[model samples]
Target: MHLRALPLDRAPVRLRQWVFLVDADERAAEAAFVALFAPGQDPGLGRALVADDGGGWLWERHQEFSTWTWFAFGPLGSELGFEAQPAETFFWLYGAPGEVFRGVEISVSAPEAQPPSEVALSRHIDLHRCVSCEVFDGAARIWTDFRLREGGTGRIHVANHSLAHDEVSRLVQTLLEIGNYRKLALIGFPPARELLAWLDGAEGRLASITSGLATGEDSQAVLDQLLALSAEVELRAAKNQFRRGATESYHRLTLDRLEALRERRVPGHSTMSEFIARRLLPAMRTREAADRRLDDLSVRIARSGDLLRTKLGLAQDRQNQETLRGMDASLQLQTKLQGLVEGLSIFAVGYYVLGLLGYLLKPWLHGWPGGAEIVLSGLVPLVLVVAAASLHRRKKRLIAGRD
Candidate 1:
């Protein structure tokens, strides 16, 4: 029996895949997976796992989500009535503790259906309202409506002509991965859209605040607003930091997976790679635009802050200069008053010395007559000069002591 990853399909074989969209909690998903698949078994599937339980199992865990794939070996009847049949693991999958993002059903017609009649294949998928394309170098053809069918799951049909066992698995993997990554990449679109509106208002406010810079308007208020704007921008950046990064990573994965398909052109259809690149680029561009806008607004805010601070500093400097001028005038007035006080003190000190000298020399003057009077007159003038010199010497001594 052809079982698990090494199924040998010499005859026409049918391969069906049901890829369910999973929540972002990898841990919780892994736990539920362990309880279901490995219960009392390996429990540690690591990242990628391949096993057999009446079918092939492909389980992969990523940072933000996980995927579980089960393929049954058998024939799908009459389009499987277009009814997607869940495998034995269906209940476990649905019961898995994660929110469904999207689920897809892939049905591959076996090698006998190789190079399926284009017209027939197209009509086969037409009932499903799908988009059709041929790939695998004319060895295989694919059809998908990309619409949620019976179980909110999109459908894809692959008719294999000459693909090897490994090639089949790899092809399925690449296609499924392309779908997964593409979905994850666009996850940032909604947040980016919402952020753009907020950014527009922030930029407008910043522009208004910046215009104030030209005309020194309400500097304090302007500074306050600038601070607020800075906080707002920073908050937005912090909030979307992971989302933006995830978008870029997922976008890259989407492209990589699409390229891995090695898609070949079918006469009248487009390759998945081309289709994805066309639509994915614009979403990525939107993310890019949002990022660029954030950075631009941040730069503008910083410049505004710098300009505001410079203006404030200049204003403070001007105020300080005015204050210094008033202080200088006050200092000059004090100097003049001090000079007058010093002059009066010198005169008063000289007068007191003369009075004491006259008293002491009165007896001698009476004896010397005119000679005594002349000597006393000259001595009085010399006494005043001595008083001034002594005061100057004392002032120098006091200053020297302080130093």
Candidate 2:
């Protein structure tokens, strides 16, 4: 509440004034204020400053822009008489952060049925076609071409209904805001046009990728293409989000200001609402459409990527099943070979045992006379059976451990 009530003064124009807000930062604006006012002159200052020259300057510092109102009340405006405005005094205005984004030249007067003389208006404004309206319950009537003159200035004529200083100042601020917000809103237009063209190309690429997907031609290649396209679309969307949002905010505010103007139709010109809507609304719509299209492209690309990945996954699953089946058949062959090897091992072991037993019997039989041979064939069956049983039990234990 306190900050809102902070001093916001327009130029001290008794019956006429023009105001300006340029794209300037705080440092440049403060420098401009100092340059306009002699050092230590007046010795009183705050966020607002009054130049020491015949016409004073109102310094307003805002976050993104600044307003420097150069007025001699009714003469010697710095911007209008560009050459006449002293270099040393107004040089700081050159250091502004950027070029002028908004400008307004207004004439305010006491209650009068007749409008102000066109003599001064003609110097800057094209008086032939003007938009005029009564506002604040007919407290004032303002006229304008809503155009930048050859000198790059906007003009307004206000026939005052005996407004006080604060009232006139508020009116000045509102008018200035209208022009500023409208410009900001429309800034998105050219970019949107360019973006639309870019989007067309992207859509074309997406179509190609989608077509490939439909044909089932090289799923890997199509999936790669989809991934690339999705990345590009997402990047574009990320970059545009801020621009889209700013334009939307500016559009909403510009319309809100128009509402506050409470404009009525003039005799020969369109109201502010009508004029801005014709140009700005469509631009905004184009921008909106572009934004929505970007989002849609992103979503479609994501879906396409998912579909391709699912197809690839299913293919991999089928291949894995075939691999598992091959392994199972190989395992059965190995099991039969292992049983045959175990049988051979048992036969060889039993033969070797029977041979050793035959030698022992020969020793026993020959002990009586040292001449008879002994046969061990009768023990072969038992040896073979015992060896087979032992080898089979060992194989069972090994197989059990493995399982």
Candidate 3:
């Protein structure tokens, strides 16, 4: 829904906004919205509802936070003050949902002939830490310390010179966004800081593992270490992915809103843009460095795994070569044994054949003496030749059939 300015009266308006960090449950946020509005009313992304007395509240739901802007026309000639209680106190009293992260009270008034003195501004804001500037091309002057009071709400006082109600509304909305998104962006800082030590340790461990791989450490042991480190890194990345991404997004939005203000410097005071940059940029840089470290660790772990795999592959190749050599030696021995067995078999068959011939010759030799002996002696070589030839032909047939 579009952002609409609060209905303006002759008197200036005072706006109070509370931003809450809600649970991830959409239904819970919706339930909270419905409780605040009419029954069965859905809390979409943005909604504006007004009361009969010309006062209303704007509601907006963000990724993990929601903002409630309440505005009412101020009385005539009212001085800038923080007499009202903080938004969190009121929410706590009425049981508002979610935890409050930021609260801002903005007072917009008609231009005055004289600007508030330092002492006067100090009554509401800490002048020592405040930012004062003219925004919207000098159409309005804004002053804020960006410091939370005892009640946990920041204060901003604006003096309108020639701006209409719509400009004022847009201005206030942008200002609120700057604060809300700035707080949301800082949420990643603590986790990022906590990860610094962890990242250091992980990097050192990875370096050691890499060195071991270089020095011919056990492949299986190195692989185990790499796997364990990779698991822990992946688990951490999965857990932090959402928050880190959100932080980056919110930080960008904060910068955009600050730029949109088109701020001009006030003498002796910093502009809102400068103030935020000074405070927020360092934290964002820290987060970016942490993310880079995580990525670097992942790459190193993958390289280590590749090294281990290569080492194992080479070892397996060597083992296969040894086994092949053993098989070759065994085959050579078997071939020699087969040749010896074939020669012995040929001799055995020849001896058996010669004896049978002699037995048959004994009956025929009844009429001859040396003739049988001579014939048998001559048959011995011929029988051996026939047996060798027969064995050789059978072996050739078997080999041919196999081929």
Candidate 4:
């Protein structure tokens, strides 16, 4: 992952946007060269040869991940040269694309007998002092980096093989002293701890999310962790900033108090106003990026929590409404059943009364029927009414259950 983007005021010049890691045969005299010139496709700005000191160049280029596949071209007709050997030296590329022309990289692995001094020496050698040089006949490799920036800020780096053992601390401190984005320099050995610390401490704080070999985990995981760490770091940093500011203010106040006491020596010192802005506040309040970041993250988290709470409340409200509707439906079915029960009771009473009347009539007309005939007719109506009521009750229950 990449570091946080530099702030507008602190943006570094886009110079050495590309970085190269290389290994070559010790016998090779010609240093390997990696560069970008634009408009590269055209005869553009010719070529600006950037010296390789300890700090490399920074440039502006577009890229996806930090890794890339690159095709090295051979020069003209020379099959073994850089231009002709397109397939000979295939390697992974990193950083921005070809748009950045901030600087260039040249690597040469040479024997002790033929040191870097011998390689870079030319008729113009006296005119252009090489910022860095190295010679390794046996196992040692010389790596250098350069920095170039506005003002006269820049640096040169030269060292032997085995990057792990090199004096990186001195190199970094020196670069920081120069305080220029253009300070070209070199660093070698697989990416290491010193480099990580230097990068994190320099410029703006590494973005809230960043990854490198030093972080020890895969890039994605490292990025996630770094983001979390960034939040805490920013908050802490902001608090620290305020603390420092207050301390400075206190110091200034003490100074003012001392100055006021000294005024007793003057004849008419009492005529002057006791307050002094400069004494009370020695410096302007500088905004820390870390503080801004913390605020942004807090706002985002708060908004997210609010949105989730609203959604949950709405869901619960909807569920309660559904329950209320169900309860209403059940009450309506119960009311209908109650009315049917009352109607059935009335029907039963009326049938009984009709049966009694029929029984009495049977006595009035004795030749018409036996007592059994009167009983059968009255019982039929009672049985039919009861059956109808049962059917209605069953239908109501089924409908209620469906609901």
Model 1, residue 16: C-alpha shift (Å)? 6.4
What does candidate 1's lDDT look like per residue over 1-403, in tens digits? 2222334233233443443444555566557665666555453443334454445555555566656665665555556324445555565455665566767666666665534454654544553434456566665667775666565667677777777656776666667778888988998998888988999999999989988878768998898889999998999999999999999999988887766666777655566777777888988999999999999999989888888889999999999999999999999999999879877788899889877877777877787767656766888778878888988898899989999
Instruction: Sort the predicted structures by TM-score, highest score first.
Output: 3, 1, 2, 4
The true-structure Cα RMSD of candidate 3 reads 3.4
lDDT of 3: 0.80
Top candidate on TM-score is 3
Give one digit per residue, the lDDT tens place, for model 3 in 1-403. Answer: 4444444443367778888777876546555654566444455534435454656666666668767777776641334645664545344325657777888888777544356666766788887778999999998889999878755789998878767647877888788889888988999999999888899999999999989989988888888889999999999899889998999999999999999999999999999999999999999999999988998889888888887888899999999999999999999999999999999999999999999999999789868868888899999899999999999999999999999
lDDT for each residue of candidate 4 in 1-403, tens digit (9 for 90 to 100): 2222211111111121222221233112111122332222221121222223322222221211111112121111111111222322222133222222222322212112233343443211221332222212212322222334222222222222322222222222222222221111111111222323433453233332222323433544544554555465455545455444443444444444333222222132221112222222222222223334445554544443354455557768999999999999999999999878867766776667667767766777677657657676767767667656776788789999999
Better of 1 and 2 by TM-score: 1
lDDT of each: 0.71, 0.67, 0.80, 0.34
Per-residue accuracy of model 2 over 1-403 as CA lDDT, tens digit each: 3332213333334222222344434455455555555454431333455554455555555544456565544432423332233554444346544456665555555444345557755665566766677876667777778777543566676766656656666776677677777887787888889889999999899889888888887997997788788888778778777778888887898888788877777677677788788878899999999988888888888888887888889999999999999999999999899778888999999989887876777766776554333245567788899999998898789989999
Worst 10 residues of 3 by lDDT: 85-94
Error of 4 at 170 (Å): 10
Candidate 4: how large is its RMSD?
21.5
lDDT comparison, 3 vs 4, better candidate: 3
Residue 83 error for model 2, in Å? 13
List where candidate 2 sits over 4 angstroms from the true fold. Answer: 2-48, 51-55, 58-67, 71-93, 111-114, 117-128, 355-362, 365-375
Distance from true location, Cα of 33 in model 3, Å: 5.4
What TM-score, to 2 decimals, does candidate 3 have? Answer: 0.86
Leading candidate by lDDT: 3
